[model samples]
Structures are given as C-alpha cells and as structure tokens.
Target chain A: MKAVVVGAGFAGSLIAKVLGDNGFRVTVLEAGTETGHDEAVHRFRTALVKSPLAPYRTTVAAPSSDYLINTGPFAYSSPYLRMNGGTGTVWTGITPRMHPEDFRTADLGRGRNWPISYDDLEPYYRAAEWEIGVAADADEQRQHVPVADGYAYPMHALPRTYLDHAVASVVDGQRIDGRELLITGTPQARNGVPVSGYRPDGHLCAGYASCVPVCPENAKYTPRRTQKRWSPHIELRTRCVVNRLHADEFGRVTKVSYQRYEDDTTGRHTRHEVEADVVVLAAHAIENAKLLLMSGLANSSDQVGRNLMDHPALLTWALMPQPIGPFRGPGSTTSIDAFRAGPERATRAPFRIELGNWGWGWSAGSPDSDTAEFVAAGLRGYALRKAVADRVGRQFTLQFEIEQEADPANRVTLSEDRDALGNPRPSIHYGLSDYVKDGLLAAKRVSDQLFELLKADDYTSYKPDEERYFEHNGEPLRYWGAGHSGGTHVMGASKHDSVVDQWQRCWDHPNLYAVGCGSMPSLGTSNPSLTMAALALRTADHLVSHRAEEVRCTMSKAP
Target chain B: MDAFVELSAELTGFSAEELRSTGLVEQYAELAQDATDAELIQLWYTGVWRGQIPSARAYAEGLAWKAVGVAPPGTGAPGFGSWEHRPRRSV
Candidate 1:
C-alpha cells in the first residue's frame, strides 16, 4: 500500500511513521525547508525581533506572510511556521492532556462535544507521550486529568522553577470560584530522568530558557525527531507545497498534486503528482481548512472551514516580594490547572493559568526595558546595578489561556490573494464569543485575588491601541493568541454537521483523512498538540487495521 | 577602547575588570561609533547596537544579564535543577 502525508508536522510525521512500520511506502511532503538546530539558534540570537518565527527561514515560494489574511473584527495573529517540523519546532513543549469534561462542553450548555470521549483516547495519549518523550509525573497529572492507574510517563517531570515555588508558597491551597488554585509542574516534552527503559534522543534540557523559537540542546521533541526514525520505506520531500488533492468519481482521494520549489529565493517550482492509496492532510488547522475549501471537497455539511478556535491568553505581570530567579528555566514550568474545569464552565469557558518564569518579558519587554528606564533616569554605577537587580530579579507574569468555544462565524476562507505558487491564501474571520470573554473576566478576578494573596505589586497594563485590545463589560481588556489553533475542520459522530468523522476521515472522501487539531470539536484549556498527536496515532491504527482487513478480503476472493 | 571600557564601566556600574571579562570591549567600542554615552550604555545593557544586534555572542554577553544576576537565556548550560534555587549574584 502507498500512503501520502501532506505535511511533516507532529500529526503527519506520526502517521507516516506508523504506515512505514506497517510495510507501506509512505511519502511525507513538506512546504518549508529543513532547518538545523544550530542554524536556528544562530538565527534566533541574531534576529532583531526574537519572535517565534525568527529562527525559521521563510521562502518566497511559500511566503510565511501569506499564511493568513485576517478579515474579521479581531486579528488572528497566531503565526505558524511552514517548516519540516511545522510549528511544533517552536512550541512551548507543554503537553497537558485535555480534561475529561473538556470532551463534553456542549453538554454543559456551551460549545460542542467531541465525538470521542477521553477514555477512547487515553491509550493513544500514553503512546503519544512516549513517542514525544514527555517529562511529567502521571500521578500529579492524574490529580486533574484521569489517566490509567499507575500510568507513569516515559520520564519524570522537569524541575519546577523557583518562581513556581514562590507562587505556590502563597496560593497553592487558595480557592477561585470554589476551585482550588494548585500549582502543578507542567508536563513538557523535554528530557528529564528516563523511565521504563525509554531514553530521550537529545541532550537533557540544559535550561536554555529559549524553548519558544529554538532549543539549543535539542531537548524538546519536534516532529523532525520522528522523521529521523522513519524507515527507508518512508520518503520525505522538502519544499513541496501540496496545494490540491485529486479525488475519483467515488470521492476517494487518488492523487496528490504539489509544486516543488527548486530555489528558496526565487518563486521557481516544478508541478508534480503522486498516486496514493490513502491521503492524510496534517497541515495546520487553518491550512487544512483552506485546502479543503480550495479543492471543493469535504464540505457536504458546509462545515469545512467553520468553528475555528484558539486559546486567547490574557497576560498579567507583577513583582515578587523576593527574588524568584525569573528567566532561568523554561518559559513556564508550572501552571494553575484548577480553573480548567468546574461547574462555572457551564456559563463560561474554562482556562489554564500558566506561571511564566520568564519575568516581564512577555508583557513589558523585561530586563531590556527595565535597564532602559534606569539609564534614562541618569542612574549610574552602583545605583544602576542595584536597581536592575532588585527590579528584574523579582519580576513574574501570569498568562491566563482561556478556552474558546467553536464558533462557526469565526472561520477560515480562501482569499483572492495568492501565494507564489498561485494557491489562495487563508482569509480568517475570527472573534471571541461572550462565553470566552466571561471566562477572561473570571480569570482576571482570580488573578487579582492571587496577587493580593502574594502581596506582589501588579504592573499589568492593557493599552487601547494594541492590536488584540477590546472592551468587555465597560472594562478595557486584551488577549494575545496562545498559538493553540484548532476546530477548523471539526469531527463529530454524525456527518450532518462535522466534516470529519471520529476517525478523522472525511465523510465525503473515504481515503482522505484531515487530522490534527482541525479535527477537535472544542479546544480545551490545555495545549492542543498532545491531543492532536493522540488522534493522529488513533487514525494511523485504524488505517493500518482497515488495510489489513482489505488484504484479507482480497485473499479470500483469490480462493 | 580602554577609554571606552572605562566609560562603559562608569555608565554600566560594572568594574573595569568585569567589563574586560566580557571580551567585547573592542567590538562594542567599534559598534558604538559616534553614539552618545546613554546609547553606549543601552548597547552594553541590551546588546543592541543602534537598531541591530551585532552577533549571538554579543547578545549572550550582554551586561544586562550580569546586572540581573543570571546567565543570559539560551547561553550557558546551567545544568538541570539549577533553577530550583536562587541564582547567585553575578555582579
């Protein structure tokens, strides 16, 4: 059998690996060029703006700027990289599984319920954790999320930062809207102590504190790592932008069409076609939706590009009473996982409060701005040194990543604007629902209480001129994209509403499967990458099983 | 460059020995051409010369990390579990 995976992201790479292990010839097509760890680290350090996409190279053939064209009230500013590993290359590496209640949001009088329960995906989640080499204590994780009994992770949890300890000192047992605010070590895809004979591939996390754009130690798990383990049967073609999927009369994807860019600078490319027994679209949620709309396929329910979602994060910063040793470890090592579920979720969306160890960098530009302020004040010598130490050492930030319900109005559509390959750009119509805004309000209230308990000086400010700024309940509010995009091509039990079934196979096309976060019905408060990997693994198992059954049927016919 | 280092020490509040330890006094002196004392101070602190950063090493050796009393992020391998305790004073 032949399998074609259009995208070398986490989902696509996992799917391709599974097929290759099953003795199928798998082809993985990527839109971006391969970037090495050292090159990315140099790029990140040299770039003027250390944005998440700073490390990755952007080509003219697949222009990163043309990734999204927002045509809505709110700007969808969550930029993704089109690289060998996709956005997983620059992810924060947190891999918390979605709460069981998160699967049934619609039952709580809001959002949409997932077709599959957490129980159905539990084993797959364990498989994905091992595949990604997640470092976390399953016992602590089980406090919030239900996992199999005595199910330990591949590695022990990464050590929590001093800032986490300081925050926990003040607010560990506190309550917010009847939910206890407990600081738990975030389950991350970085190396810790190996367990169950599962050793991580790269150097252990050496506390680079640059996990966003680049991990110098290669400790964080990116899809490129999975690609490295692929067998000879699996082939990876870089700089190949898969634009369209050709389907047969029966609506089964038969061929994959793409433009292979020869040169990175010039828009030079060659058109290529590859026959496939099955096609899996693991391109990002927005990209998958755009591809489906452009091909005029899998919209039988008219829900191909609808029900978009993201974790709109509200940042709150403050100064600790003492030096918490900020900007030392990972960007975030712990989070308040309490607010992720409760009865309050019925009226408002749930959220996760990430404890940022990187000080005021995300909010006020950190030690740079603090130094600039002191210099402007004409403070020199010992006075300047003491001021900076006192100020920068005590800084910390709390990021409230609120869940966004599936709103069909907030969708991704094709624009008249075309990329270098003449493919239509993804035009997004995104906005926060009232339920999400209510959740933000509750988060702010909880933050205020936590700050009061910690006795820290709050320095969070929301300016009206900001791009993500808005007004809610006569109060100035703002949110930034957590880069957790999902729900564009949602999955459901019935084909009447969702584009993909529970197996992530398009109902309109049997051989076509649209996987990744795009298949999620409701993006929970947790990061979507782990769940996306689990779903991809599940789909890969199904495809392998289905192929085996087909072979058996053919054998029976031969007799 | 000696004069530049002395001025940087005075402005940044680091001793001349500490300033020389960074080994970028000459490179920074060249990059800070015609820059005011304040601009030079900002360059030493933020590792941003004019509008652009000179190099990755320059950023890692920025005086700001010293002032903040921690190694520059993504630079030194501080070992695992180093962040669990308070950082020692770099200055």
Candidate 2:
C-alpha cells in the first residue's frame, strides 16, 4: 500500500510514521525547506522583532500564505509557518486536553458538538502525550479534564516559576464571578524530570524563555523529533508544494499533483504527480481548506472552507508590587484553570488564563521599551540601570485565550492574488461574534478583580488603532490571535453538514482524509494540538485496520 | 573607541570596565557614528543597531538582561528547575 501525506507537520509526520511502520510506503510532501535547530535559534537571536515566523525562512515559491487579504470587518492576523516541520516548530509546547464537556458544546446552546465523545479519544490522547513526550502530572490535570485513572505522563511536570508562586499566594482561593481561582502548573510538552524507563528524545528543559519562536535546547516537542524516528519506507520531500488532488468518479483519490521548487531565491519549479492508494491532507487548518477549495474536492456540503475559528486572546499586563522574576523559564509555566468551563459558557465563551512568564513582551515591547523610556525620561547611568531592573523584574501578563465559537461567516476562500507558483493565495474573512465579545468582556472583568486582589498596578491598555481592535459596550477592546486555528473542515455525523466524518476522512471521498485542527467541530479553551495529534493517531489506526481487512478479503477470494 | 565607551558608560550607568567586559564596545563604537545618544544607549541595552541585531553573540551579550539581573533568553542555560527560586539580584 502507498500513502501520500501533504504537509510535514506534527499530524502528517505522525501519520506517515504509523503508515511506514505498518509496511506501507509513505511519501511526505512539505512546501518549505528543512530548518535545523541551531539555524532556527540563530535566526531568532538575530531577528529584530521576535515574531513566531522569525526563525523559519519564508520562500516565494512556497510562500507562507500568512499575509491573508482580509475581506471581513476585522483583520485575521494570525501567522503560521509553511516549513518542513510546519507551525509545530514554533509552538509554545503547552498541551492541555479538552474537557469531556468540550465535546458537546451544542448542549450548552453555543458551538457545534463533536460527533465522537471524549471517551473515544481518551486512549489516543494518552498515546499522543507519550508520542509528544508531554511532561505533566496526570493527577493534577484530571482536575480540569478527565485523564485515565492510572495514566501518567512520560515525564514529571515542569516546575512553576516564582511569578506563579507569588500569584497563587494571593489569589488561590479567591472567588470571581462565583468561580474559585486556582493557579495550577500547566501541562507542557517540554522535557522535565528524567525517568528511568521513559526518557524523552531531547535534552531536559534548559530554561530558555524563547520557546515560541525557537527552543535553543530542543527540549520542547516538534514534528522534527517524529521525523527523526521515521522508517526507511517513508520518504520526505521538502520544497514540494501540493497544489491539487485528483479523485476518480468512484470518489477515490488517485493522483496528487505538486510543484517541486529548486530553491527559494529563483522561482523555478517542475510539476509532478504521484499515485497513492490513500491521500492525507495534514496541512494547517487554513492551508488544508485552501487546498480542498482549489482542488474542488470534499465540498459536497459546501463546508470545506467555512466555519473558521481561532482562540482570540485578550491580554492583560500589570506590574507586581515586588519583583517576581519574569522571563526566566518557558513562555508560560502556569495558568488559571478556573474559567475554562462553567454555566457562564452558555451566554459567553469559556477561556483559559495562561500566566505569561515572559512579562509584557506580547502586550508592549518590554526590556527594550523600558530602556528607551528611562533614557527619554533623562535617567542615565546607575539610576537608569536600577529603574529598568525594578520595573521589568516586576512585569507580568495574563493571556486570556477565549474559545471562539465556529461561525460560517469567518472563513478562508481563494484570493485573486497569485503566489510565485501562480497559485491563488488564501483570502480570509473573520470576525468575532457577540458571544465571543461577551467572553472578552467577562475576561476583562475577571482580570480587574484579580489585579485588585493582588494589589498590582494595572498597565493593561488597548489602543483604538490596533489591528484587531473593536468597540464592545462603548469600551475599546482588542484581541490577539493565539495561533490556534481550526474549524475550516469541520467533522460531523451527517454528510450534509460537515466536510469530514468522525474519522477525519472526507465524506465525499473514500480514500481521502483531511486531518489536523481543521477537522475540529468546536475548539474548547484547551490548545488544539494535542487533540489534533490524537485524531491523527486514530486515523492512522483506522487506515491500518481497513488495509488488513482488504488483504483478508483478497485472500478469501483467491481461495 | 575610548570616548564612545565613556559616553556609553554615562548613558547606560555601567562602568567603563563593565561595558568593555561585554567585548562589544569596539563593534558598537564603529556603529555609533550614525546613532543618536538614545540610539547608542539602546544599542548597548538591546544589542540592536539600527533596527537589526548585529549578531547572535551581540544579542546574548545585551545589557538589558544584565540590568534586570537575568541572562538573555536562549543563552546561558539556567538548567532545569532554575526558575522556581528567586534571582540573586531580586529587588
């Protein structure tokens, strides 16, 4: 059996590995060049603005279509990589499983419900945690989501930063909006304690605060780790952009067409096609939708590129009364797990409050801006040095990743603009619904109360001219994309309402699967990477089992 | 070079020896001809000269991390569980 997986991201790499291990030939096609760990770290260090895409090089031939032309009221400014490892290379490595209630959000009269329940995915979730080498305490994590009773992560949980300790000291038992606030160590995929029998591949966490753009020590999980463990049957072709998929009248994917680029500098490329028994689209949510829309496949329900969603985050930063040692560890070591679920979600979106360890870097340009301000204020020498230390050391931020309900109006469509390969770019139309806006309002109210409880100086400010800025209830507000994009190719029970089935296989095509966060019906407050990995593992198992069944039928026919 | 280092010391509140210890004084002095007083100070603190970082070494040696009493992110491997305790220079 032969399989062609598009996009060498976490999902694609894992699926390719499983297929290769099962005696199937797998060809993994990636649109971008492979970036080495040292190269990425160097790029991040030299970058002027340390955005997520800073580490990876963007090629014209395989352009990261992150600069989407917006046709909606608000700008969808979330950027994703199109490199060999995909956006997984630049993730924060925080992995939290969705709550059981997250599968049935429609029951709360909000987002759509998932066709499969959490019980069906719980085992796979554990498998993904082991695959990704997640370092977390299953005992503590079960408080938020249901983890299997005896299951524990591959490694011990990452230590909470001093800032987290300080915050918990004051606000651990406080009640806001009738919900008790508890600061817990978030489950992260970065390496931690060294266990005897279950050692992760990479080195332990070395306290690099640059996990978003790059992890210098390779302590965080990336698809590159899985790619390193692939069997000889798997072939990875970088800089090959898959443009379309060809399906026969029987709705079986027969051909995968792509353009192989020579290099990024020259816009030179050659077209090629490969035949496969199965084709998997493991590209990021937007890219998968774009490919399906371009190929005119998997759109029987007119839902291939509709129902776009993202965890639109609202950030609130403040200065603590004393120094709490910000920017010392990972990007975030702890989160307020109180508001992730409740009865309030019926009227507004639920949110996960990630306690930022990197200080006000996301809110306002930090140590650099602090130096500039001190210089401008006529402070020089020792006074300037002392001021920056006092101020920046006390800096902290609360990132509220509010769950966005899927809306058909927020979508990705083919743009008129063409890339270097003459392929149409992804045009986005995104907006926040009233329910999400109410979520933002509720999050701000909670932030105010928390600030009061901690006696911290609130420095949160939203400008009117910001890109994602909007007016809600006569107050200016803004949101930043958490880079958790989903719902472009949603999964459902009925073929009339969704593009893919519960197995992430296309409803219209038997041999085609579009796996990733794109197949999620509703994104709960948790990060979607772990869930996407679980679904990919499940799909791989399904494909392997079905292939066995086919072999058995062939043998019986021969007899 | 000495004059540039002296000016940087006055603006950054660092002594001449400390500024020279970073080993970026000569490189920064060469780039300081086109910079304003504030930009020069920012260059020492941020390792950013005219919008671009000179090198990875420059970023790691940035004075801002020293001012805040922490190593620059992605450099100076602080080892596992180092963030749990208070920094030596906590205010």
Candidate 3:
C-alpha cells in the first residue's frame, strides 16, 4: 500500500516510522528544511529562534502598535515549524499526560471531549513514551496514575534534581482537601541517569539541555531521527512544502502537489507531484488545516479550521538567594498537576505549572533582565558577592498551562496572500475566551497564594494600565494569543461538529488522516505535545488494525 | 547599551522609514515594548547599537529582573528568603 505522510514532526515522523516498520511503502513529505548533522548545526546557530516561532493564527496584541496579530472569523495562530523534524525539533520535553478529566472535559463541566477516552489512548501513550525515550523519577512515576493495562513506561524515570528533591520534602505528603496531593519530579524526553543498553527508538544521549535548539549531543529524538532508522521502502523528502492535497472521486486522497525551495531563493520552479492511496496530513496543526482548506478535498463538514486552542502560557519566574546553573539542564524542570484535573489546591479553577529551564535574563533585551537589574541595583555594590552566590543554584520559572475553551471564531482560513508558490497562506483569526481569561485570573490568584506560601517576594508585574494598552474589542477581552495554536479540525464523535473521526481520519475522506494538535478540541493542563504524540500513535494503531468501521461508531458519542 | 544603540543607528545609515519597513523594526520595537524580550533584545542590541557585549551571565540576569516579578521589598506577605519550587527531573 502507498501512504503519504506530510510532516516529519512528532506524529508525521512517527506515523512514517510505524508504517515503514509494518512493511508499507511510505513517502513522507516534510515542509521543513534539512535534518542532517550540518543542517542541524546551522539551524542551531541561527534558528535558536524564539521560545515559540511559527506562522500563528491569533489576535496577538502588537507590542509596538497594539495591533493584534490574530483577529477575524477564524483561528489566528503562531503555529508552524518549517523544519524536517517538526516542532519536536524545538520543544523542551516535559511529558505529562492529559488527566482522566481531560478525556471527558466536555462532560466534566468544560469543553468537548475527544472521541476516544483516556482508556483508549492510555496504551498509545505508553508506546509514545517508549518510542520517544522518556525518563521518569520515583514519585513522578507513581503520579502518572497509569491507565495502560499490562504496560508501564518503557524507560525508567530520571532523578529529581536538587531543587525538586528539596521541595518534595515541603509539598509531597501534604494533604489536599483530606487527600494527599503529591507533586513529584516530572518525566522528560531528555536523558538523566545513565542506562547501558541502546534504545530501539533512535540515537543515544549524554544529558544535554539542547532540547529546544536541535540537540547537539544527538540524545533527544526528533522524528527525523527515527524516520532514518526505517527500511529503504520508506522514502523521505524534505523542503517539500505541500501546497494542496487533491483527492479522487471516492474521497480518497490521490495526489499531493508540493514545492521544494532550492536555495537562496523563494521561487516556484521546483514543484513536484506524488500520488498516494492514503494521505496522512501530519503537517503539525496549522499547515495541515491550511492545506486542507486550500485543497477543498476533505472538508466536507466545513469545519476545517475552527476551535483553535493552545496552552496559554502565563510564564512567571523567580530569583533564589541562590545560583542555578541557569544553563545546565533542559528548558523545563518538574511539573505540578495539583491544580490540573479540577480546581487546583486552595483555588476553584484548573491550571498547571511546568518549571521553565531558561535563566532569569539570558536573552539580551528582555524585561526579565530589567527586573533582575532593578533588584540588583537596589542591593548596590554588594552585587559582586550576590552574583557569585546566586550563580550556584537555580531560579524557578512557573509555566501555567491554562485551558482554553474552544471558540469557532478562533480558527484558520485561507488568506488572500500567497506563499512563494502562489498558494494562499493561512490567516489566523483567534481571540481569547472568557473561560481562558478567567482561567488566567484563577491562575494568578493561585500564583499570588503560592508565592505567599513559598514566602518568596512575589515579583510578578501586574499593571492595570498595561491592560488599557493591550485590551481588544473582540470578545471585549484583555489577552493575547499564548502563541500555542490548536483545535482547528477537531477530533470528535459528532460529524456535525468535527472534521475528523476519533482516529483523526477525515469525516468525509476516511483515508485522509490528520495527526497533530489541529485535531484537538480542548486544551488540557499539560503541554499538548505528549498528548499529540500519543494521539499520533493511536491513529497509527488504527491504521494498522484496518478498523475503519470503528471510526464511524464514535461519530457522535465521544467518550 | 547606549553605545550599541548608536552603532546600530550608524550601521543602518538608512533613514527611519527604511528601518520601519523591516521585520526587525517591528520585532525590536515589540521587544522594547515587551517587558521580557525588551531586556534580552536590548542586551543583544548592544552589539548592533554601540558594540560592547556583556557576558551571558550578565545578559541573563538583566532579563530576569523584568521577566520575574518580586514584591517591592515588602508587601507584608512574605520576605525574599522562603520561596519554594519543585525541580523537574534532570535531562
């Protein structure tokens, strides 16, 4: 069978691997550039880019002119990764699964739920963790609350660092409303304690913090890493921007038209055509939806790009009277779900905090540095001693993963503007919902209390005036895109509401599957990546089982 | 930092309108407007502006102040020493 996978990122990459392993002739059409050693080094040099960089669809308040980037009838997101390996090439891997509540979010007093339940995805998540080579620690391992039957995580957990180890004494074993709420070291895709044997996944590692910018040590697994491990039957092509996907009369995707950027130029002379029996649109999220809309191939429900969502990142940091190697570890540390499933501890709302691994003010012109300098200047000439002392340990960053209620107005549609190939680029039309804004407020309330509990001076900036300068009339809201795009082309049991079935196959074109966050209708407390990876594997499994019939049953009764 | 800003002005040699058209103009202006990116960009801008560059430690610390917020000395809630955080597992 001939299958076409359009992305080399988490899902696309993995789908290619599984199909190649199953002995199918697979052709992966990646929208990104090269993924070999030299190209990886070059990208590391220049594309150490931003914390999040992609063509997003959101009404982002322009800091300069107050012009919002995301606005309109569709979801505006800054969600694209034009590299061979996809977003995994730029992610800091902290793998926390969506809670059980996340599976039934719509029923549990929130947005819609996935077509499949936590039980349905639990096994796939296990395979993903193993395939991704994640490491967990003691309490972290136990905290996963495993739902996978007869299977645990493939790799052992990494050790809790000094900071987590110390905090565990204070927080863990603490009672939460009469029930013990334990916060443990989180599972990470990076390496920690050494394991002797090699992983079947791909590559080896030496515990490098280079998860975001391409892994210099080759330890972290980008999808490209595994795609290479497959047999020659699988053909991998990079720099191939898939402009449109065309289908036969039977609703089967038959032809894919893409262009390759030769070099030092942005022209359309390098277009190519390939035919496939099955088409898997794994182009991350945004681009896939854009392609679907551009092609008009599988959008029978007219819901190609709606329900945009992302983990609104309310990033806050703190300074310890100590020194954290700041640059030592991965870009994220431990995580807390204490506030995830339901209302967090002592608060009546839901959210989660992942420890960021960046330093207080590593970047040159960030406000974080200004704040640090302000604090240091207050201390005057004593800076020398303070700097040395503070350099030894770590400062903590709190990354709040706030849940966003899916709004149809927040969507992705074709823009009048075209790319280098004359294909219409995606325009993001996104706005924050009161649900998320309220969630942010709830998170703030929790942050204020937590800082009080920690007894650290709360240095977070809260400027009412800033809101006046930032608020927009749409939704009459005062927030910007978290830059984490999702939802567009959601997976659900209802054909009326979603474009894809639970297996991420197009409702109209069963052979057309979209793997990525574009299929998500809800934002869970954890980062969307781990869930995306799990969903990718689940979709792959569905394809492997040849169970197209089951995909029809959950068309309206999402678990 | 001031010196670097001047140097960037010199390097451009172009008029204001020219710089305004570039994405860097928007990105930089946005950085200046952003409490976080502003500090980081300004430090890096030192090279483009006047030219002297600081160490990574100095650069990171400069951004952190604005990125993280602390109660001004005392909000009566708590002092600086007792804050708590859970560390993630080592990579």
Candidate 4:
C-alpha cells in the first residue's frame, strides 16, 4: 500500500525507508530543508541566535525558498533547524533501548504500560537496532532482562573510558541492594572498534557539545545517511509543513495537505497537497497532539493533548577540587546510575537517575567563545591560577532527568495568537506534579549523597526554588522540558482511555496510526527518540503484515 | 498546574504547603479542561510542567482574583509580561 508519513525526524524518515524497502510507494513530508556543509552551518547558527528552525516557515503567500523557523513544540525548544534529514543531523549518536521495566511502568503501578507489550515490539526493536547500526554490548545491556543468549548487536560496543574508573573511585561502595551498585558504561551508536571497510571519518570520541548543533567531524549517523541508502521508491518533500490529514467516510486517510514555508525572511508564501492511502503522524510529541486536535481527529477521548510528559532535567553540579577534563571526550562519556532504577533509599517505588559528564560543572556554550572568556578573566595571569587549576580533574557533575508519571490534567492548547500560517501556536500548559516532586526529592537526596561521597564542593543545582527566582523576557517562566515530551495521544489497550491501540492504530479509525513518542504513557529517564524510531519500524511491519492478510483474504474469497 | 501554583507562590515567598491547599491545582485543571485550543493548554501546562511560576504570592492571588472576579491586590493585574516568562525564555 502507498503510505504517507508526516515528519522527517528519526521515526518518519525511517518509516519512509522501511516502507520503500518493502515495495510500498512512500512520500515523506518534512517541515525542514536540506543544506550542505556551509549552508547548514549558516542556518544552524542563525537558529541559535534566532530559532532552531529558520528555513521552512509554512504560510499561504511566502515563496518556497525562504528558510523558516519551526515554532512547533519540541522542535522550537532547541531552535534546532530542521534540515533534509531532520533532528538526527545534530544528535550525539548515542543509541539506547528502553529498559524492560520502562514497558511496564504504569502496569506495575510504578509507571505505566504501553499499549503494546514489550514482547510484541521486542523483535521490531531488534530489527531497528540492526538497521540503524547500533553498537550495544549484549552482556551490559541485558542487566535488567533475560535477554536471549547471543542477542545480536549491530555494531561493536564503544570502549569504556578511564572516566568510568574515576567515577567508580568515588562511588565504588555506594550502598544499594545490600551491596554496591556499580555504575557501568552504556553503548553509543557511533562507529566503535571499526566496521570492516568502513571509511574512517573523524577521531573516535571528541567531547563535542556541538553534537546537538553541528557535528563537524561527521561522526553522527543521522537519518540523511539512511535516506541515501533507501530504494528509489522513497520520496522526500522538504520545507513543507503538513496542515491537515483528510479522511474518507470509511475512516481511511485519503489525503495530506501542507503549506510550504519556502520564503519568510523576505516574505512570499506557497502551499501544496498530496493524496495517500495511509497517513502516519510522526511529528514530535507536542506537535503531533496539536495536529490531531486541529484536524479534529484522534481526540474522541478528549485526551489527545493531555497528560503531556517530559524529562525534568535538574542540573546537579558540584564545584570540583580539580577539573576532570570534561571537554576531552563526548559530552556524556560517564554516568552514575547509582539511583537510576528506583526511589532513593526507598524499597517499593523505582525511579531513574544518572550522572551527567558533559559540558563542564558550569555552562558550556561555544568552545572558541567560552575559552576566550576564561582567558580574558586573566585565569592564566591570576595569582590564584592554581585555584582555577584546582578545578581541573576534580569536578563531578550529575544531571538527573527524573520521570514524571502521567497526569491527564497537564496538556497542550492552541493560543489566541496565530503563526505565519494562521495556525494557532502551541501554548504549552504544563506543570510538575506531586509524583514528579517525589522523584525529584529522591533525586536531590541521592545526588547530595553522591556529591558528598565524591568529596565535591557544592556549586549549584536546578532545584525548583532556584528556577523560580530566575527571570527573563520580563516574565517568570521556570518550567523546563527535555524536548522529550509525550503522552498527548497515549496508547492503551482500550479506547475509553486511549486514542490508539497496542499497535498504535487509531481505535476509532483502524487505518490511521501515530508512531512516535507521543503515544508513550510515561517519560522514562532515557531519551525517547531512539525508541520512537524503533516503534516506527514496528508500525511499518504491522502495516505490511495487515496488508498481506487483506490481500490473502481477498484472493481466498474470489470465485 | 500545582507545580506552577507552588512555584509562583515560592517566587512570591508563599509557603509551599499553602500553595497546595489553596485549590490552585483544582482550578488549574479546570482552566485546562475549559481551554479552547488543545495546544494552548499544553503551553499553559509547561508553566506547571517545569514548575515555573511567577515568584509572587500576588500572582497566585491575582489568578485567584481572576477566577473569582475580584481585583488583584498586587501591582497591576496578573499580566502576561509579569508572569509569562520562563527562566531562559525571552519576551
């Protein structure tokens, strides 16, 4: 069957490839543009000072040439310009799988259950890891689950660094489970060890916070890389923002309409519409819910844009006696999961927390610029150079993104004001919940314990009270989301409380489905993008199988 | 919404527990449900989501006043510029 996908992020882009490979005609509508090295850099920088999306602004009169800034929820938060391949362009290339406990979060009464069980999607997740060329270790990965013997990992796991040893020195005997819970090294999607015949690009692991902005060394595996390998049946429409999904009387998606934000810096507008037998909403979490609400579909439960979830990133920092060469490797090389799996010092409920070894104990902006500031501070000329020197090799930072259980009252809504396309901008109406407070309280205590054990000097924290006092834009806004929001159109076994079924199909409209993190019920500690991609693969497989079943049934009924 | 109310009260130096008992959570939930645009509700909730709130007890009082049709006791009304800013967000 011919399928249309909205979004060019990890999920949408992958769906296009999978469907095309499976002999299905595919059209991928993306709300971003494609730029080569120099041009990509220009847009990336512009978005930093301006908006992450300045290349494709959808409107009625702008020509399809001007770069537009995406005002969509998660996409707007970073000002990350959407280019040809999507957000994968600047991703750190860290590939991880959701823990088995993540799947039963809600069911255990601890978190929430997915519409589909882990067993149902496990194979697809395996297939996706293979297709994306991940490098996870079988032994380290199966810590929580009974992973089958010899579970294949596509790429070789990256080598653990010395930083792990340093961290272990600090928390080696950390008490948990009547013993020490050793913080182990996780895997990365970056080419490790070396693929045979793989052309080497850059050094293995350079601490580049720019991974989210620009990977100058080309070590990242963005969707653009996958698109290049796809069959000829795949098509991409960039700089286009899908406006609505039109459905036929039988509840089948019939057409997809979008406005191309090709011109805006100067000002001209254009629009386009395409028809497809099936439509999948792969736009990131907030936008996915907004589109469903705007299009008047997938909200029979009236919960389409409710229960919004995101990782509450609390920057737990400590002033170190010496710096740990934080800028020497990938932004996140070593992490502390001493309290990642559960509540702090509590027996019943389990939550997740991890150490963050990126940037520095302080803010990490552009390296060239930040280094100059330090130099200007006379760090080298100061008599207390040793004081600054003391900061080296001794700093320990831990950023904990605690999971917030689902609360339906928190959600998204359209604003009175409209954007360039006259579509109401998504006005995020979210708040931390008591459940989150419980998690954060545990996180704070655990982090304090970690800091004390590491012998770190207290520096600063991202506590709620601190965020409240900080001010900007002449208003008091302190809510921070990881851009990893979800649960707007949650998946569940029944339609009474959910919009989609286990397979992500619309309960009211069987032919329609949404295959992104938006359907996730809870925001686990891990980033949801990789898992979102895996789900897209699962959805593609389901669509293919269902189509085959229909064809076989039709043939059997023939005279 | 409870997060925002508590956060707002915190900024204004109100007791956190008092922020909870003030029916702010219940009222905010009502506002979300009554909001016309599903997306706007999301934006409003971000304030709640991040626990970002106006650092003024008066802000909560103003919100309360708005709900009850009473005049706010603080400077001006509960205007957007007065309470709409996230820590890093610009006007």
What DockQ do you compute for every candidate structure?
0.76, 0.77, 0.05, 0.01
lDDT by residue (tens digit), candidate 2, A35-131: 7778888888899998899888888888775657889987887778999999998898999899887899899738799999999999999999999
Please give me the total number of clashing residue pairs in predicted model 4.
83
Docking class of 2: medium
Question: Cα deviation of A439 in candidate 3 (Å)?
Answer: 1.1
The digit string of per-residue lDDT tens for model 1 on A213-265 reads: 88898889999899889999999999999888998777868799999997999
- Model 1, position B82: C-alpha lDDT score: 87
Cα RMSDs of all predictions? 1.9, 1.9, 10.3, 16.8
Can you write out model 4's per-residue Cα lDDT over A11-79, one digit (the tens) per residue? 777887878888888888876556675555444433322122332333332122122233332221322
Report the number of backbone clashes for model 2.
Answer: 1
Clashing pairs in 1: none
Interface RMSDs of the predictions, in order, are: 1.2, 1.3, 15.3, 23.0
- Docking category for candidate 4? incorrect
**lDDT score for residue A522 of model 4:** 62
lDDT of 3 by residue, A460-555 (tens): 553455431133222222233344567888888988878899889898886789878889877677777778888888888778778345345324
Q: Candidate 2: which stretches are off by over 4 Å?
A: A549-559
Cα-based lDDT at residue A47, candidate 1? 78
At residue A174, candidate 3 shows an lDDT of: 61
